[model samples]
Target: MKEGIFFGEGMKFVKDDYPDIYDAVVGLNKAAYTGKVLDYKTQKLIAIGIVAATGDETATEKQMRSGMNELKITKEEIVDALRVVLLTSGMPAFTKAMKVVSKL
Candidate 1:
């Protein structure tokens, strides 16, 4: 509850209007917490990479910035991940993703 944030309104919408998706998100949280393949920071970085590779701009931008802030992931690391994505997902797919990363 800060003076001008919309967190409460957004949470209310998720709880009231998107209850089913909200419930699934809770379940997904449990599954995610159970997994331990990578460290939390690494996992977040991988998630950023996947989002970028899939061309999800909103998610990519969010994760890219969050990773840099919370996980201390450097821009160079993100750039390397994008390079791998380029090889696997094709340059055409990665082209837009790289653009998004570069803006970061």
Candidate 2:
């Protein structure tokens, strides 16, 4: 399988040791990106916010990079999303997200 930038060592281990479950997860990921109502770029931005809200620095960074690289997402748009996180998820989550965004 091609190496995924966002997928860490644990995901690689699961893909190697639990192929069936990994396949299921891969299927679910595909299903999530089908773009029934929302477009892929929008979905990716939403994913970034959700990941950031969880306070996973690595995942937030990966998602931010992926969104920018693949979807051409603007830093301004990302900051706008983080504003929502600030209002709903609080300053800590927003600050953490800002730190990642600042790096990019």
Candidate 3:
């Protein structure tokens, strides 16, 4: 397996066993990250919020750490983003996100 940024276990498995699909998915990820308006950090933060709102604890934690370590995103900044989740996604989602943030 190749070493790269943020390839989940499933992606790793796909890359190893199904190179064609992995290439397509990797291409899609690259395209998604190349948006003209939002910067990479903002996109990552949004991804974190989406994952958090879904109550996917593992994905939330992984994305949180990736944003912090790779993008140098501050905890305060993440909390600020979570505020949007609170308003739109409601208390449960926001609270779950908060708990994930607290761990980091």
Candidate 4:
């Protein structure tokens, strides 16, 4: 991953200390994000919702930022995705994610 790309956990330490594990994870991410079916933007939208459902503020912001920066996705599109979190994950998670999204 690029130095500032907000990829999983940086993975630098893992690469240094545990090359095998790090390689496996990198392969897994590559396979998962192949984007042969759903395009990457849709995948990103789903990712945002999943992370938002967990109510992880930092992650939510990072996802939104990455989506915006990398895919040029709009806040409205992200809000649409968050609505799913609202239904499936409930008010607290939805509200928390919405708050973060709102700032962006």
Give the alpha-carbon lDDT of every model. 0.70, 0.84, 0.84, 0.87
Which tens-of-lDDT digit does each residue in 1-104 have in candidate 1? 11111223465678679988767666765566444776666776677777777877776777778778776888888888888888888886578777877898
Choose 1 or 4, whichever is better by lDDT: 4
Please list all clashing residue pairs in model 1, or write none if there are none: none
Alpha carbon deviation, residue 70, candidate 4 (Å): 0.8
* Candidate 2 residue lDDT tens string, 1-104: 11234356687788789989888777778777888999888888888899889888898998898889888999999998898889889989999999999999
How far out, in Å, is residue 66 in model 1? 1.8
Colliding pairs, model 3: none
Candidates 2 and 3 compared: the better one by TM-score is 3
- In the range 3-100, model 4's lDDT, one tens digit per residue, is 23436675778888998988787777777787899988899899999999999999899899999989999999999999999999999999999899
lDDT against true structure, model 3: 0.84
Residue 102, model 2, lDDT: 98
Weakest lDDT window of 10 consecutive positions for candidate 2: 1-10
Please give, for residues 1-104, the per-residue lDDT of candidate 3 as tens digits. Answer: 11256447787788789999988877778888875899889998899888888887788889899899888999999998899889888999899889999989
By TM-score, the better pick of 1 and 3 is: 3
At residue 32, candidate 2 shows an lDDT of: 76
Candidate 3: list runs displaced more than 4 Å: 1-4
How high is the lDDT of residue 54 in model 3?
85
